[model samples]
Target: EFARAPGTSDYAHNTFVDFGGVTAKNVRLTANSNWGGMFNQYGLSEVRFFSIPVFAREPSPDSGTTDVDVDVTLSFRAGREAAKHDVYLSTDEQAVIDGTADVTTVTEASHGPLPLDLGTTYYWKINEVNEVETTTTWQGDIWNFTTHEYFVVDDFEDYNDYPPDEIWSTWIDGYGILTNGATVGYPAPDWNQDEHYVETAIVHGGEQAMPFFYDNTGSAAYSEGERTFAVPQDWTKHGIKALTLYFHGDPNNAAEQMYVKLNGSKVTYDGDAANLTQTAWQPWNIDLVGFTGVNLSNVTELSIGLERIGAAGGKGVVYFDDIRLYPLFSAVVGTFSIHPWTGDGDSGISSSKTYTHTGKFTGEGTDGEPFFAGNGVYFERDTNRSGTSWTLTGAANVFGTTNPVTVADDSAALARSFFYGDEDNNHPVLTLMGLLPNTEYVTTFYTVGFGGAGLRFVDITPGDNLGYPTRVDQNGVGSGSGQLIKHTYTATSTEMSFMFDALKTGDSWHHYAFSNEAVSPNLGSN
Candidate 1:
């Protein structure tokens, strides 16, 4: 029990106490006596408790922010009782939470204009330190942010002639191996009149580059440099879409097929083979989709190689540098329905094959059977189709966020099964959310009608009066029930709206499906 001074009054004003610091599950306060010497006569008005001010709060890039610059400095407001700060940072979230991250104690409240890796998320924390206080350390809350997605795969700047750091240490070339004619780096005597193992003179955006010599002759018809990753990398993360590499030709090099392989899945460069003999640096950008059949999320190996296209034997050296991965751009392409999708549940009208959905069905012959396409698309049903009401559905995986699709509809149905708009103005408006801004997308809509005459007509618009609405009537083609209607539009923000207005009264909008795809950027050649 603790006591105050003899002159301290208990009932005159609010009481204050300094407990220094505490770690407890329960705290109790007992009043022994009042100032008037009667404990039962006095009753408490209010009681409060306060914690220690030991948190370093308000971080700069704010927590969980995206698109932060790669060269960013982290800063935080110091705690009220802190004399110094211990900053911990790492790419691993568990390491930071366990206090095992790279740490530095500093008098300042900031940590670095750091040269962090691109397209990566970093976790950090600041522990307020005060050696003189009763509580010497106060653990901080973990904060994280993602950097801009544009990181280098390799730049050849770290290669050296020393043991285990040589250019050939990580990059396996065809030196002693048979049936391959690739040689990496120069010998110690100085093939290029230089002491370094890397080519410093023919570098691209760096101090050095790999001198990849290829000799495709006799039984050895190809030359390649291969590297196996110690840890498999996920190319699909952070919205990565393309891989780019810079190569400088020697003008005397052999004319061969240039290609790259990811986990043994090869993608040949589509540019002219003569670019290998141009004596200038050229960029080759390959869409990740071109490396088909490879698990892009778990790529374990990479290879850059050249194969002789003709009977003529040739040999020369080429310089490569600055291999990098890039994120998505503002471009979209074609659209199609996920296959095995038909009426009666085999491949019938469904919104998505990948995303999960919840729905209620009434009188039907398998009207809302689920389908799986393995592609990153989702579908949802708007059960309230009687009045003009908008409803949102959840989507995962593709957008990396919740609430990706919304639908607004008005229609009438038979036995709460077959649906059609009685009024001319009643229709459905689809809103796609979490899309890349300024990106163009082509969307396909499937309209199925149960009417035998197939007399349903509707006008579909891609956006709000962006252009003339495409007028279409049900063709009753697919299994004698439906046809597809398509539209293309550019998203101005994270959200875009599409309208499907009934062009004729008594027209059916019975079952519906929607699909969208982004246009593929120029791959392999650019």
Candidate 2:
């Protein structure tokens, strides 16, 4: 006899059978269950028979493999009423183990008593059986996992102090207004002195006030000096990469000049000294690489001279600030290319150009167009054309607008001919007169509405028989509705000529040219 019924539980629907009614000799019972019902109910029925078979337990994995060390552990329970079972573990493939063992066992449902090897993969399984000596064959799924080395970083730190090491100071004197007293020289007193130089905030001639020493004897008499601090021998031994000098100049006097010497070697002011003024403290960084001729490895001293190169009558003063020496470190300098004829024959213009390229610029309108125009020339990037090019459009008309355009008061203007443009007929043109002959040059144009624009060269020479006889034509249509057309001509002679034939005009085309270089008496000047 056999009976089937559902287990008395709400959480699970399990089927069980009662065989107590079977009263037969040598009786045996067998049961089978399967999933059933919408909610996963189960069915089970019992069968009574004689001669139940006995079986041996599956071999357990060696205990050594069962409790291996691992970076992390994982485990899971077989079922709510499931009894403790033996778990077996083995390596990937039945590969022969060389001194390394391959078997392991887990007594219960706990994971890892992992293997001892790091980053080794292994397979595992569990076997279920009855308390009696009867058991079923290995009936568990196989799983594999690998171990990995892991670590954590703790307590990391970095530190930096600006203007590292060697220190120097600047001071202004002869104002009779010395805060520390009547110091003899501008920036008077060496680093050991009681007083050092300070920059004046007042600006002169649109420039900063500078460090100065004055002598109001009513005669051309004034003396100013700058002192450098002592540097360690090891500093030069390791190589000094840079020197920062802080100084102030009379903003009103552009002709003032100052000389610097490090360890008695003249320090070239790579930039304009006349342009230095005392509006705020200024840092002048000098690259010591150029002074290769000087043995900086043994450098021990530094000095500066306040010489008045302007009208000797101007009794202006200069100021100085923080002076320092910085050790050389790996420094990356950005690279840029500039045409030779881009600036005046003075170093100031070149320095200004370099600064403009490397410094951040901000103005009104998108795409670098300045809202107002006062002194600055706008630099524009041309996207409609190929090749690395730029254009500078003048701000004349832009300045004439109801909302006049204005650049910063302290800024200087750099005008060029090649200005970037869109489909609109709004590009700029160059306005120079004579250009060097047969030389390749880049021309930048500036206009009021447009901004910075540039043009590269194939060849440049004097225009036809006209004063400026050579002409180069740039032809292309902008991405917009209009075309970009222009002809640049260079004058061969000093006389200026505006030949109407030299001008090309059309609804979709236009041309103009000019030379800005002075005609040189020497033919070799070209």
For candidate 1, what is the TM-score? 0.40
Q: What lDDT does candidate 1 reach at residue 23? A: 51
TM-score, prediction 2: 0.29
All models: lDDT?
0.63, 0.33
Candidate 1: stretches off by over 4 Å: 1-58, 62-75, 78-146, 191-193, 329-526
Score residue 304 of candidate 2 by CA lDDT: 54
**Residue range 56-112, candidate 1, lDDT tens digits:** 999988999998987798999998899999999999999999999999998988988
User: Each model's TM-score?
Assistant: 0.40, 0.29
Predicted structure with the largest TM-score when compared to the true one: 1
Tens-digit lDDT string for candidate 2 (359-441): 11222235433322122322332222211122223212211122222222322132212222222333333223334444333
Candidate 1 at 390: error in angstroms? 50
Candidate 1 at residue 265, lDDT?
89
lDDT of 2 at 92: 47
